[model samples]
Target: MKAFITLVFITVTLATYAQTKYSNEFMNIGVDAAALGMSNAVTASTKDVNAGYWNPAGLVNLEDRQLALMHSSYFANIANYDYAAFAMPLDDRSAFGISLIRFAVDDILDTTQLIDDQGNVNYDRISLFSTADYGLTFSYARKLPVQGLNYGVNAKVIRRIIGDFANSWGFGFDAAIQFKTDNNWEFGVMARDITTTFNSWSYDEEAFERVQNAVEGQNQELPETTEITIPKLQLGVAKTYTFHYDYTLRAELDLNMRFAQNNDIISTSFASINPALGFEFGYIDMIYLRGGVGNFQNELQIDNSESLSFQPSFGLGFKYNGIHVDYAFTDIGDQSVALYSNVFSLKLDFSIFR
Candidate 1:
């Protein structure tokens, strides 16, 4: 009962700050500094363990095994997001990976509007709770008999909890396919939440009921609702160029199209579509510089003018002796000045180190 009440507080706190495009919005934030640095435009160019969350087919690039961990400071230190992934090559033709991510806010103080019989504010009744979102995914990829063709699928489980007020469980599926050519051109197609992910929420009304009589002026009731996250199709293409100086340059583009309206975020009258572009420059495979732009939206108008929304990102990376560290700066938009997010990630390739 205590846990449930705490969760209720968490739920209310989360509802006050939710700014999402769909259900399970945390999953859409993207994982790993390396990818975010490029505005997550590497769907076709992605390789290694992080592919567990991107294009699983990219796991084929792992010779043996790889592990990656990432952390992000989101939205002016209001929340923290973290991810970890591991990929292992099962054989020459198959690979598998697992990934986990968590997003949460802590130290929220909960208060009541009810006043005691003596008309004194209840100072001893303050409660603290946290709201968090979690995702776990299992993925597998296989190379087809046809050269340069590969396919992958992911099974995901999701859970969201609010201090004790509400909790939810959800399931979803994702699939991806990729084709590459000897000339360094790659193409990718991905279907996210192909099964139309649904979240079932259950709320505890005990706390609200306890204060109902005292706070009758403000009518409030715990709500029980189910939310569905619509599916989206993403198409991507990338090209790699190799230089005589042992350097490489790559460019990538991606388009995301929503098939259904997300009542949770955008109005049904508006369309949800966006394009992203990214570039990366690498020196002897040891150092890299990346930059990109994403979240282009022009559907709604604010102040009688076409509302503009876009996020710009950039990053740096270092790799040597089987270890890599990466950092990224992503602008989340104006929050006073321009709010920039900082992300850092580390990766270890056991194939080379062990």
Candidate 2:
């Protein structure tokens, strides 16, 4: 087991090295923080739950105070993540909200190299590496009763810190429009990551030294360095019909698209049409079941003629009072079980101000 873990560490290091810093590291994190993450979309217009994270326009329809917390993570050794939020309405025309999210990879053994004057490699401190992502957000939504539509905007300032190496500060804003049909068919459009980003490499000695060197062979580097922006656009539609008094079947479809600055990276710009179907039969909304599959865009054959493909994912959750817990599983086969990874998260939410 120890050897397997060590091998995984090496593989992850090299895999991350081949790509850019922070590549895909934060991609799968913070998903379980929202029940919507479990079903791609949960009863969207219900008070201002974490559902807002998936569709900002949903905030416009909230009626009262709502708070939520979600935790989930994966990998063989386990990576931890956290997400939380609160939202409410004012004057029957506007709403406000705030949120927090985190990503942490713990117990990572730091490699060390010691040298005796000759600058030889020597193992040193047994440390770990970690990173966290958090954002303070404010949002407002106005209802146009004449058209039965809602238009909203959200502003968030984000901070990303990675160990002692890199830190970044940026601002983002999202615009969303939502409206429902006469038959209660809801539709929403949202665009995310529309702000500029700058990563503070100076926060770390090692990363800064590398930047300085790159500038040596060229013109003076800019005072503040920045990375490319990754933007995501999504269109969502959902409809629900009562199966019983308090029981209902909710089906949602989201056409999600994320594009990177580099066009040659064809995979980054591709879109995923995620269809999630869920059934909620709770008497007082105390429990839920959610299952969905995504990331199955392509098929590939392994090196030796064996074929490998992206696997489907499923999750389950239960809620009581104001707290919730969830778990997700991905099956990639027995040999690939170690890489399949299981994600588990806990959510905490409650109403405080009526």
Candidate 3:
């Protein structure tokens, strides 16, 4: 019930502000520094610890001990996120993994207006686009007896902070089932951000008081309420096929059930399935190249042609003894070239034991 409410409010807020401001939505874009470089999709067969982010079920592929850390730098010098995960095999059929992800939007300078009813500009103040979010995940995976197939699930708690204000955290869960076919064909299904959250957007008495006084004079009480909603309910099904020559083919279909419209964070989702496809290849285990095209219907020459901007991405990766590094480039489809320029990331993985 709480999850349902959060999504409702987040959606309402987005719909209201969609015409004016751009907000972050599906691409809450994680800090998988490496996977960002390769258009992701490496999780189904990933043997490294970073698998915890892509598909917790992939942890079942970890042979022994591993630890990984990743960081991503986004556009506008805004929020930067870091992710760390540890994984180990519990037995031949099961593995346990723990992951921590932290997000901190860089301090921002915002303008606040102070004016009289007579259209008099009294004064203005500077504020910040502030937010601090963190998520903790506990994941477990078990390999099914048949043909290297595995099933995994992760439960997580997400918390947020903004300008001395924190809202009640929302809970989320991820579940995926993976299957491997002969040669190197694989398939996966995942549900992400199942626990959509909406934050308490109550104005701070200390901070909002300034705006109140600016508009309402001294002791007049204002009668208005503000609330924001977060979108919820997403389901994705993906498939992968690998060649002995080290070439990989990947594709996924993601469906975001938007019960309400959130123009603020445009994606052309409109309660339907969005298609994404990519391929990757490596030469003798040294260098890798990957690329993909994705997005819902939108107005963009490079992608969709109506609602939200489209996304086309590509990535590169390198591997060495017990360590691997990767990177990716993405187009957010924003009209402003600078804002839509690109999204980049880096990932690092190390083996703790043989």
Model 2 lDDT tens row, 48-102:
5554565555676666677666555556546666677777777677777777767
- For every model shown, what is its TM-score relative to the native structure? 0.88, 0.72, 0.70
Error of 3 at 170 (Å): 2.0
Clashing pairs for predicted structure model 2, backbone only: 69-347, 71-345, 113-122, 114-121, 114-122
Judging by TM-score against the true structure, name the best candidate: 1
* TM-score of candidate 2 relative to the true fold: 0.72
lDDT (10s digit) by residue, model 1, range 276-342: 8899999999999999988765534566665556778899999998999999998544223357988
Which structure is stronger by TM-score: 1 or 3?
1
Worst 10 residues of 3 by lDDT: 18-27
Model 1 residue 291 lDDT? 93
Error of 3 at 244 (Å): 7.5
**lDDT, each prediction:** 0.79, 0.53, 0.56
What's the lDDT of the predicted structure labeled candidate 2?
0.53
**Which is the leading candidate under lDDT?**
1
